[model samples]
Target: MTQGGEAAQHARDEGDDGDDAPATLPELYAAHRLGLVRLALLLVDDLETAQDVVQDAFAGLHARSRRLLPDPDRALAYLRVSVVNASRSALRRRRTARGYVPPHEPPGDSPEARAVLAEEHREVLDAVRALAPRQREVLVLRYWSGLDEAGIAETLGISRGAVKSTASRALDAVEKALEAKR
Candidate 1:
């Protein structure tokens, strides 16, 4: 069979890769986009920055889709790693920007929905910002990005035991901070 014929037969035999049916890059993006965005938001503590981070991740994923994973499950894993890296990059950039004039706050008194979202957004952002950098990164990768300890460790370049301990410590710290804030 020609290459095209083989690809067609494989596609048919695979039945769209079964439950893993993210047949195209766009399909993969659609399935995981919102969750990835939210994970990035929690990691970076800024929604606009989160969107940018997710965007960069998607771009990277698109470029490497063919070589990164033959199966959708693994592609999702690749996307998760991309998001984590992009979010960390955004955090570094924000650190550099901190030396400039104080960051501007969004104006208050918009529609009711906007007002409510703004309040909740600030609360979550504050809670995340209270975490130590390593703790925050571990927590976001494990819980927010839905990565297992091994995956988190691999992504963060730490050991699995370290990921577990740091995640436990991070959760304790976050709870304490929230409790104290009350």
Candidate 2:
């Protein structure tokens, strides 16, 4: 162990490094998780990515700590740094993976992208994701895939009339969802 590590070990062995600090992993996680996630969210701009960054930060600390952090408060500082670095890495990965589109996302072809950039497409994307699975499947197949009702029915294993109804209903639901958001 390094000199700092030896000192931290000695502090832990002596117990009570003062101020009623958390000495265990669970306690540390409980104390700092919310703040860490918020920090990550500010950097990453998405709750899921922020949560992932925090989790990864904790996991990295765990990997090195050998099941017990020698100094939990110092470990929290380490975790804050790790979360920041991990969020940067996440943004870089997202930038490099520009081709990846999540399911149910309407394609952002240049013209449509420009059109919706004026109107906030997040509402539409959220509406699509909120759709029922069958409805979503029908809508994507019919519109994005440029399939006819019969083709969508064939693909989704439903009757043509069912496909027509599902698509109509899905479109109505998406409209309602967007309207509600507005």
Candidate 3:
């Protein structure tokens, strides 16, 4: 299976269990924060930035009135959008900094983390990271986050048609890149 397939399953597993609907902010955060962090991690390729992105997303939600976000699904969607945008901003800053630490730190920055992702998975991840930003974001959202086109469109603030086209192109690009490695 592909790395994205495993991530999709992982995300599904992280979702709220049935009959235990999140009714409060803390409950909602507990139910979905990790998934959001994983999403950001895929985009930014940095755990520290991913965590900060998630925390900042939650902070934004916390700053708003509860009345503004009463539904768990709505709250989750908001968080997804926030994470995506924040992840983009982090990427931009990283690029602007130029001389900063490179994305390709040779092997096992953390063996515990490396042990979790196989060499094949790491190869797939590096390929994904090499993609254009929008393509990478669409692929991660569609496959890793297990989000449908509408969800991606909403999260990205783009038209549904754009989401459909972007995901199609992104998938083809990923397929070509992976195949080229064969």
lDDT of 3 by residue, 5-108 (tens): 87777766987434566868888889999999999999999999999999999999888737535667778888999999999999999888986766776664
> On a 0 to 100 scale, what is the lDDT of residue 165 in model 2?
89
**Which one wins by TM-score: 1 or 2?**
1
Best by lDDT: 2
Note the Cα lDDT for every prediction shown.
0.83, 0.87, 0.85
Pairs clashing within candidate 1: none
All candidates: TM-score? 0.45, 0.45, 0.43
Candidate 1 Cα lDDT to native: 0.83
lDDT for each residue of candidate 2 in 1-182, tens digit (9 for 90 to 100): 99988888887788857567777788888989999999999999999999999999989888878544876767988899999999999999999899777689766579877777756677777898899999999988977899998899889889999998888999999999888877
Ranking by lDDT: 2, 3, 1
Q: By the TM-score metric, which is better: model 1 or model 3?
A: 1
The better-scoring model by lDDT among 1 and 3 is: 3
| Residue-wise C-alpha lDDT for candidate 1, range 58-130, written one tens digit per residue | 8887788787646777778887898899888888887888867876887766699788788766767687788
- Backbone clashes in model 2, listed as residue pairs: none
lDDT at 135 for candidate 3?
83
Superposition TM-score, candidate 2 onto the true structure: 0.45
